[model samples]
Target: MATQHDERAAPVPCALTPREERRSDLVDALRDSASVGLGAFPMGVAFGVLVVHSGLEWWWASTFSGVIFAGSLEFLFLGLVLAAAPLASIAVTAFAVNVRHVFYALSFPLHRVRGRLGKAYSTFALTDEAYAVTAGGAGRTFSSRRILGIQAFVHLYWAGGATAGALLGSALPAEVRGLEFAVTALFTVLAIDAVRAGRDVPTPVLALGCALAGRLALPGQMLPAALALFTACLLARYAWTRYTRTPYARTRRGGDHA
Candidate 1:
């Protein structure tokens, strides 16, 4: 009985405890990631089927799942690989394809991440879904370990689902069409949640603007070029804030500096 009680009372197997603040953060992250992951998993299934059709072996698809990890890029590069495109061209294309991730990386709260492996895993698992999860997670403060858990769960879910899809691709052909919209719906809910949370509208609006601008201006290279544009816009916003400032408090509202 003592041993059983001790086991039940054992440490949480993580750096951060499930305190009030941390627990809330974890819940938020889970909610955020779950939404995004639902949408992305279908893409993984499609990729799994593509893996079989492209003459690549199981490990090929699984490796792409584990390493490359980005759904759109994986789809594109798989096509490129099948077409026998030059590696250099593919590398350039992949860089441009996944470049928005660099901005995401920059925005991620790296300070909360704890140890080396935790940080590395957080970096490695930095997918759109994972980012949504981490960003939406309810924590006011975080440790590296907590973030790693959030990230790792999403990453593993993605890869595991991909692998399962690839392996069972033949058995589940009927599940293809309708099931594929999960990832889209997931992120849609997250976007709505963000808006409903009423914490910040600028984030989604800025993202939307950048996306629209990139689609209009950059087209094929939207990811990289838009990221650049977004960075510039953020800098410009900062400059405006620092110099002219905005009306927030009564002092600023009265046309005086706060």
Candidate 2:
């Protein structure tokens, strides 16, 4: 048994200064988020430009970026708001478009975030790019500070770029013909990059097949329907693979035991 004085005398672990911890977290976060920030900035600028040209007030760009902070859904909101769609319609559409984020939360490293403010911001900034950056080898083990920093930086990139574009969009041509396709182009690039990185032919095949089926079955609700179908397909594939592999895995285990 140690005396109270001896226990008190024992060395305690050195705690990092708040500033030093923040600096370390910022540096790591910037390193991980730089690519996503770069990509999002240009897209955000495009969005702001589109918003200004759509006869909406310039402030709408900042408003949407700050409030929605959703890339694809923000684009759709432009048309919906412009059309003055029913509130119910907008609500449903927004949910359908962003339902994927609900799934994203299931695997996002949210538990690492501490404090109400940190967790709230983490949840708010849980974009696709953020998820992509922090879902793998080194990212999975990142500290809460680093995770929060990455999310903050990415969020800033979008908000800042949108504000800049809103300011500049007035000088551009009034009727930009192909601006709407930028979102589609961005997704196309992302898809190609994912395929290249994964080399997973079946996923893309399933995605394409589901998208086509959704378009054919319900053209107006294609995106949501396609996502639903794709999810089901993926789940089915997972189950089938697990079922088929378990027997072989058991046999290999038995052989090793023998």
Candidate 3:
């Protein structure tokens, strides 16, 4: 009876220690970010190659990768740097190019992460790839450590790839044909991927429509104009959804109660 009572009282399930739990979370994060690293690393290498071919110092590849850390904007910055575009133009252009990040914040798992610094870094490091990967991990219930680990891993992949490519590019011929087209190709691929994700269709539609209108209306200022138009449309959509949905929901609830 004593032996049976002891057996029955013993825990049936084993629990992971804190260290083991952390290790498991980190492994999961790494696995989740694996695809992102693959995509980012190769493109980063291309960016570094382009930077070197553009006659900029090799260190600029790693520098921009670490500081600006924005893939598309970094590509655009190469041209802007070479052309010596005015600071104001650069600022406005960068904002227009990257304004879509504002939308990513709406659904990002930022609230799950702890610590002000961790949250801040996650926000700063939030790229399209990171957002996509994290969104997919919504089912996994990502922990703070996992989220930070994924971001850090992606950041390393980009920065390390750029540094490596810069070293390799320095040894290659300066007149590399078609290297400059990398940015265009990257954006095209990104757009296609966004469509395929099937998250929302109207955003891309609004972007295309606004871009076309901007091109026709403001030839030299298409980017800024299109961005402005796109932003306005998004705001309008938000307002319509918020204001229109709430009243309808309330009315339906009231009628049901009545």
lDDT by candidate, in order shown: 0.71, 0.79, 0.79
Task: Let me know the TM-score candidate 3 reaches against the reference structure.
Answer: 0.67
Show the colliding residue pairs in model 2.
none
User: Distance (Å) between predicted and true CA of 169, model 2?
Assistant: 1.6
Ordering by lDDT: 2, 3, 1
Q: Write the per-residue lDDT of candidate 3 for residues 1-258, one digit (tens) a residue.
A: 234434334333597655677789899888977867767887788888888888888899999998888887898888998999999989998887887687777668898889999998999999877787776435238899999898888899898889888889967555445554544554566567656775788888889999999999998667668867888898788667756665435445333432
- Those runs of model 3 whose alpha carbons end farther than 4 Å from true positions after fitting are 1-13, 137-140, 172-258
Residue lDDT tens for model 1, 1-258: 235434334445655434554666667656545656666666676778778766777678788988887777888888898899999999998887777887786557776887887777778778887776656545325556567767766776677777877887766756646776676677787778767775666767887898899989979887777778878887787657656755334344444543
Candidate 2 versus the native: TM-score?
0.72
Q: On TM-score, who's better, 1 or 3?
A: 1
Measured by TM-score, the strongest candidate is: 1
- Which model, 2 or 3, shows the larger lDDT? 2
List ranges where model 1 is wrong by over 4 Å: 1-32, 136-140, 196-206, 246-258
Candidate 3 global CA lDDT score? 0.79
Q: Write the per-residue lDDT of candidate 2 for residues 51-156, one digit (tens) a residue.
A: 8888788888999997888888898988998999998999998888887676676568888888999999888888887887775545668999999989888888
